[model samples]
Target: MTLKAGSILTGTIVNITNFGAFVEVDGKTGLVHISEVADSFVKDIHDHLKEKDKVKVKVLSVDDNGKISLSIKQAIDHKKSVKPIEIDWEKKNTQNAVNFEDKLSRFLKDSEEKFQDLKRHQDSRTRGYKKNTSH
Candidate 1:
């Protein structure tokens, strides 16, 4: 069978080196780079993968020489479906109402203070204008 990217296939570890492990998959062979073996740090390939051991591998790339590169990490990291969290709509609405009320009250109080300051400035200007025009 033709192997494609993201394809998961069973393979036997044929060779283990300091760099990586060579795996035979579906009559074809590929190299699992040392970095693509596991999630955690691996000092040695022999510490994680063993010779003649069966493992599930994901096809990573194919070279010009038809040399295929595989990854055991990708296969292990396939995402499983998970249900989304449910929220309490009633409680959320109540909390939102309280927050909205607090914010609106603060805004109104600030606006009233600004208006009072503006009226005071306007009254002072009006008095100054009257005094100049009267003289």
Candidate 2:
């Protein structure tokens, strides 16, 4: 298969280095830079990939010298975008309503308890002041 820019291809990790991993695809090898290995920061490439591991890579560019630039993260993102999101509308709506009601009731109960505590504190202070002034 001809490897072209933006094309996603499956390849084997032939070698791993401090800077990147070399992947072999269709008898040709391409470099997946450490930064292109994953979506997040890759402090160590070995943490995410191993030699002989199969990976999907999106071709970033093909140089005149046949050097190919690839990105695993972009390949994953492309796959994710191609999939359709599934949701049960009825189930989600009922669950959200129950959660909202539970949260609101808990908040109201806590507010009322705090208000009562403050009222009691104020009443006690008023009584103490009255006793002192009458003396």
Candidate 3:
């Protein structure tokens, strides 16, 4: 089976590393990056995958050096099919209407004040140097 970009391929997990997993498919081995392993953060790769485990992965890219990039999350159909709940924004917050520009300006002023306060505290902590008598 010739591996191409966007192609779904079944392969065996040959090795696992801190960065990714090496999978062999159609006589060619590819890497599935940690981010591509699943839809969520993978603290430990061994928790999600193991050697000799058969996995269906989607080919993301075929680099010029012939390295194949794969994504197991993309291969699996995990899209939400349920309809989202629609919210009536205007009715929900009619009484508490606030201008975004005003809020942003206030936030910037607050941030600047806090930054100045921190700078002053830091400068005070530094020992005051005496002026040199010989110049």
Q: Provide the clashing-pair count of each candidate structure.
A: 0, 0, 0
Tens digit of per-residue lDDT, candidate 1, span 1-135: 898878999999999999999999989889999999998788977889889999999999887889999999888744563356898766557787899999999999999999999999999889856455654
Q: lDDT for every model? A: 0.89, 0.91, 0.90
lDDT of prediction 1: 0.89
The C-alpha RMSD in Å for every predicted model, in order, reads: 5.1, 6.5, 12.4
Give one digit per residue, the lDDT tens place, for model 3 in 32-79: 999999888999999999999999999999989999999999998656
Full ranking by lDDT: 2, 3, 1
Q: State the TM-score for model 2.
A: 0.59
- Cα TM-score of candidate 3: 0.58
Segments of candidate 2 deviating more than 4 angstroms: 78-135
User: Which predicted model would earn the best TM-score?
Assistant: 2
**lDDT of candidate 2 over 1-135, digit per residue (tens):** 898999999999999999999999889999999999887899999999999999999999999999989889988866656778898765657787899999999999999999999999999889856454653
**lDDT, candidate 3, residue 19?**
96
In terms of lDDT, the poorest run of 10 residues in model 3 is 92-101
Pitting candidate 1 against candidate 3, the one with the higher lDDT is 3
Clashing pairs for predicted structure model 1, backbone only: none
